[model samples]
Target: MTAPDPAAAAAPSFDIRREVVAVMPHLRAFARFLTGNRERADDLVQDAVVRCLQAAHQFQPGTNFKAWMFTILRNLFYNEGRKNRVKLDPLDEMNAGAHAMPPDQQAGLEFDDFRRAFWHLNEEQREVLILVGASGMSYDEAAAICGVAVGTIKSRVSRARAQLARVMEGGGLGSRTSGNQEMPAEMAAFLAAGTPPKGR
Candidate 1:
């Protein structure tokens, strides 16, 4: 009998690696939302990719690979947090002032204020918001990733929105509409872009 072809034998692993690479942009965006720092986000993505490769055998086929990878990334983030409480630097006011939008750019200012309020939210609140609100995942999916009840994820998203509204209002943005009102246009656009705010 001819010896088995090693490359053919490794094809499954290679396929999984390609899938991981395919979702890297999404992973990087999520990481940026989680870390609020580009450099740290890149490192987090790298670490998550490594963990995924190491645990490749444990990954069941015919599953939601993106969700699986996201779960791994989230767990890795929390694990590292527990081991070494990483501290991110505060947003740079000087940089913000230097890049300040023109006075007529009211929408830009509102978006900037929203970004500031977003970072002020607690990690749990922020995570739920990003997962459901920004990332467009269903509450059920977010709940699974968060290991919480569906209602808990909903509650977190609601509280996060309320808190963000309060923060913006406190910053002289005025009261937002109530009762399932549409989110602010600027906020919606910002979240849709999924990019970290300047000076974060």
Candidate 2:
């Protein structure tokens, strides 16, 4: 028999890398939600991508690649969190340049307030919301990544939404044009985007 083609042998690995790169934005957004620090978030994404590359052989084809990558990222985040508590630097002038927004715009101000409220959420709540509500993962998929039951994921999402509603209604942020009865349209768009909002 002829020797196997080297290019053919490497095809799967190359495809996996391509797919991983395609999802980098989502990974970074998730990392941001987890760390709340831009630099740390980038580091976390880098680590997760490295881990994914090293473990590519274990990834099953036709499975949900996004979910698998997210599991890797969440595992990495928790593992690192256990090793060292992350210290977040304040968003000062030095760092502000990285994510500059027009202060005069109403949408920008509202987004900033929403981000503050989002970060104020407990870790579990934040994770669940980002995974299900923002990242658009189904509850079952999120449950598997989070290592919890589907019901648990659903409950976390429900409570997180209610809490966010309360926060917005109570002026934890500013008044939303969507009114107090529902989540603001901008916040809903942000959650459903499954990636970092613009200027984030």
Candidate 3:
């Protein structure tokens, strides 16, 4: 057999691989929130990584690699929905963050309230909230990943916050689930903590 050019078979760039490693926690969190199950969420992230590595040549330099990776994972969620649904995991994994929660905090009874109430949010609401509010993505980045207009992304985020707050309030808190209200403290803290690792 003829010798092949080793240069042509060079691996994905060190930068991309580093970013992918940094982004894994966020990707896992996003997948868990979207799929509403832990094991399947891990599976989704694994598949997305494999797909990303296979298509690394298509990655455009000086662009948003985080957004690019998220777009891949999001596409997998939709395109592979049938196979995914058969996993039959309950939306019971609605803590969403699963492992993302700070160790001491998530075990509180308050999060139980947060969990059931969060599960009340429709998937679209949850997705946008996680992307913009939790994952620390820009509005433009979220819109592009969602394949929606910027305005629509804004609307969904606004509504997601409102709905999340409303649901929690209405739940034993006895606050108004009405009017446009943003997510309350625990939600904010959770979202804040949900951001991807920052070391680069």
TM-score to true structure, per model: 0.73, 0.73, 0.70
Model 2 superposed RMSD (Cα) = 8.3
TM-score of 3: 0.70
Instruction: Note the residue pairs that clash in candidate 3.
Output: none
Quote the lDDT for 101 in model 2: 75
lDDT of 1 by residue, 26-47 (tens): 8997887777667777888999
**lDDT tens digits by residue: candidate 3, 147-200:** 999999998977776677666645544323223554556655744444333474
Tens-digit per-residue lDDT, 75-130, candidate 2: 98898765774664434312343225776555655666566566667778889999
| Candidate number that wins on TM-score, 1 or 3 | 1
